[model samples]
Target: MKRIIGTGLCLLVLFGYPMTVQSQTLPVVQRFVLNVDYSRFWQNDSTMYIEISTAVYPNLILLQQDSLGFHGKVELNISIQNKSTGAMVYANRYNVPIHLADSASLVRTGSIVNNTIYALGSGEYHVSVIGSDVLDRTRKDSSSFTVTVQNKPDSLALSDIELCSNIIESSDQKDVFYKNTYRVIPNPSCVFGSTSFPLVYSYMEFYNLNTNLMYKITAQIVDAKGNVKKQRAHLRRFSLPNVVDVTTLNCISISSGRYTYEVILSDTLGQVKARSRRPIYLHNPNVKAASAETIVTARAEFEGMTSDELAEEFRKAKYIAQSDDNNTFEKLSTAQAQKEFLEKFWTRIETEENGKSNLSRSSYLGRVSISNQRYKSMSRAGWRTDQGRIYILYGEPDEIQRFPNSGDSKPYEIWYYHQLEGGVQFIYVDLTGFNEYTLVHSTKRGEVQDATWQQLLR
Candidate 1:
């Protein structure tokens, strides 16, 4: 195995930004984009096992270009604090090396996932992880979560479920991935779908099982609204007192969104014993859209929304909102005022059928969900992107003309709307080549229009 670089750095090649100094001296500070997650298991009566998993984007980090292509690195600083005594229990750092053959390979490689495990005494503790771009110290992200690890060897209980990218049979005990005769790869970002990770593999530990007793394990995929989307069950009679189990689900047929990967344990008599649940996000673009049930029930559930949540919803709704409606919301700093404002705004904006208003709030929101699932990019949410804005403001395009990279040309797409303005089309160009296409031209009214759009491809 090759050693990876974490905090150590070579000669600095930092990217510069324009400042009052007027020279390219100051580096632009950006968020070190990544996701950190973990799972807890009983190692013994007095100790607990903690595995920290991180998924980070290689394309998002700053790198130096050379004959070897793009080279960069990221580091994760992990710390465990004992909450009872307000003391630090454990600390360590890990490295992730990134190598890209060229710019185009960035989108295809997706994110790099890494894992590290630690053992700590059974107690309540706070775990913190800080991710940083090794070349740019100012670019970093930090997150923390509390865990209560308890002794479970004498009880019939299951450990915290570990979401994974892969699990394969392995005999290489010396390998860092080797665990319980299998190589388990964790997906810290918890993103799965067709364009992203398609298989959802869950690894968990079962303890204090009776060899003669029959047990049942139920695995389910639940949507954000607590609706079960897919489920299956298995039965087994254990031959060992403690064992590890791996279960997998194919999310290709499921819609993209935030959901829960949950496991339930029960006995032959259907008595529930243990359950573990973790949130996961799926990004299955074009496989399936979000369900209507999840969108339709969202309105009645918006009673206690925070001010930020209310304002964001209004921002999405602003695609169809008039200037006056936006101005009205800008003054609504209070939750109650924003909620009341949105109700009246929707009443005036929702589509009408047979001289009566229908539930367009849910309908519009469904479009937003679909856009977010299909068109999201590395820099911004799909709902905020140019293509997503168009999809929400208008319906789907009648035809989409796609063009991949050709000689002297960047990848671009032309979306045509047959009904809008009699005949209209929107052109998006991948100026960055990371799939963050920008709208350059459009024939539709009130849209960005560039008559010489062909120059952009050149």
Candidate 2:
């Protein structure tokens, strides 16, 4: 007898049992067998891929006039093994049904499957396939194959990975884009206990559909002002098999502030593929407290100075102000306005007050008077000069180097500080050949380049 076993249906049949004496009996035989095939196997430096195919075969079976629709089920199992060691590397199982229509004259192709492995060292790999016939209810048919992983050339330079944080994708969308998922790590050596600096790091990855590996990548860090903080680049002649973990990027010491990190990927010819941005916040409570202390100490140092010293410092501040503005202080229209402005300015810089003991307020006013006496030019007081403003805001610098006019060398002065964060330096040049000095450049921690004073000259 025969039975049609369609999808979602199960069938069971039994032939006649052996007869008693004088009766004839037919032998029982299995009706179905299973088979599996692995058509292809290949490997890169660190991974291997396998393509699989499966089928089933019919065995001898007793059949009657109605035995025209016999059908059976088959189960398939695939696995990868290390030929050197007898251990199984990977395995998968699948179920398939064989219909009567699939006779020896007509075999059907099975579904194709692909698998991936990561971080595998170069070596020989083995793959095995096994099949079981549900009709015979036995694990009878099986097959096996082998694959080899060869070492890739060292010419493939694996670049460092960058993670970009807090990158807003578009002007309209104030949120970070899905495409931007780079991460940055700060420098551990520069990190002070409980002190945070404005810093960021970034990384990214790309894939070449043809070679199935990454091609090129780039990463950078920038401040809120759109200045480049740091940058790195990488290029690959041939495609890599898959993603790799590169070294982390670091940012220099910065104050507590907001920052953006960016990662970019492209082809060898510089065709952009993917881009991402990340935002990060560094917070250090101790640094904030220290900055406040610095401001207080600066104010006190100015108040404690002797009158002669104060006068000299005030003269310097005035010289700076007058040198820039044609020796003119923007005049106050009324005495009351001047008085009020001075009061507000002094109050902003004052940290404490004890009635007559308020030295901060007293010393600041004294400096203003001295500036007026020493730097008064055609239209303004000495205190209004560029030099005057700097001296009044920050105390006298630790050192000053002066260079008098000589040939093409212009008259210039370099002021240095000893204990400031990243140290401080200012260079003033008398570009106009006048007696007045003009601020040319300011450097903080040997990194920041401030040309605000240069803008005045221009």
Candidate 3:
């Protein structure tokens, strides 16, 4: 059987900042972006496992020519100390590598995910991770986190809730986070869109289920206003020591907003056993007026495309097009006129960057692709989403901080751009329980920067 685990999905990306090094011999101050997720797994009655996965950015290190290829690597040294006694419990080291075949690969800023497992009893341990860029030993970063492990209780209980992007039957068990004869793909962001994902899949394990006793399970989709939109309840008996509850909820008709999907477990006596809630964002299409840029009657190569495809591109241009541009496109009588409008549309966003016109167009289209990949929610394409609009206008963010199901706040994310129109940040919140994070506020001029963003988190 395949199993999945979770604490909460935390994504931390580093920005350029200097921090002091612990060692006196190393005078260099370095910045590191690290993201990690830990989940407790029961291996047996006497043993438990803590799975730790770490993602690190390669731009934070220096690359050097090696026999295999040009590579940048980091040595990860971890130490676990007993929190109660302050005694060392375990220590280990692993090397993480990043490789590039050409010097032009310097622009790559992707992350490398590495995993390690540790066995411990039911107690608290302080885990200290020190990462050193192998090519430049002076550049190092350190962070510490605490983990508590415990043996599965003999009584009825539920495992930590895991929100997944995909849960499917596995014939060979190829995925790491597999359990109960299935492969579970976790959505660390916990954001879902209708076009890309129409259903929300959740998984949890019920431990110590009695074969003779009946259990009641309730799953609810609740909005931010404390209203339940959809619900499912089931009563069943289990004969196994561990029974996995996998629920798939249809989100097709759900409106866009911030909401929560909660699972409640109860016994036949009406006593609550275990309950878990996860935040979700739903995205619905929003209507907007077209731009009004002066119409350029000259035809362009885009005229060769089908009308549907041309209309889609114009719809995407809604972000950058002016009101007049919108009016002009709407007024266009021929496909040739629409193509010319697109030519001027791209030209309007073009700049004298490193590659000029082609570069600007390429860059804009690239943002479109990324927006679709990262922010597209149910029912709407990524380019039509709010985040997609901002990304196309402002390019990549310098820093991204995501808070998923944290505290009293709804699932939200903050995007910071150090040099955009004088240092601005965009805040997005999933006000509805679907996975679409609409822009709640922004620091950029002329954009909606709500002063009451704190209240929206609830």
TM-score of each: 0.59, 0.24, 0.44
lDDT of 1 by residue, 1-458 (tens): 12222111111112321123221222223334566778888877778778777766654587666655666888889888999999987777767888766555554565676777778787799988888989887777676778888776577878888987778899987767778999887776665667545788999998888889899999999974577888889999889989998999888787655567899989988998888897776655454445443221224656977766887788788677755454345422235445555664565456333221243777788889998998999988898899998887776888999999999999999999887778889999999989988999998777899999889898
lDDT, candidate 3, 327-351, per-residue tens = 3443232343345446656655563
Residue ranges of candidate 2 with Cα displaced over 4 Å = 1-348, 352-359, 373-380, 444-458
lDDT score, candidate 3: 0.64
Worst 10 residues of 2 by lDDT: 1-10
RMSD versus native structure for model 1: 20.0
Top candidate (lDDT): 1
TM-score of 1: 0.59
Name the best candidate (by TM-score): 1
Candidate 3 deviant stretches above 4 angstroms: 1-32, 57-75, 99-112, 129-143, 173-180, 186-201, 219-236, 248-261, 267-271, 277-458
lDDT of all the models against the reference? 0.72, 0.42, 0.64
What are the per-residue Cα lDDT tens digits for candidate 2 across 1-458?
11111121111112233223332222324323222322111234444233333323332222111133334446667677778887776666755554443232122222111222223345677766666655444435555556665554333322223232222223432221222232122121121112222333333333333364445666665654587656778875445444432323445343333345566667777887665564543333223322443221223444444423433443443422222121111111112222322332344436443222333656655666665665455555667765655554455678989888666677778788665555778777776665566666777533336665544333
Candidate 1 residues lying further than 4 Å off, grouped into runs, are 1-31, 101-107, 224-226, 287-291, 295-458
In order of TM-score, best first, we have 1, 3, 2
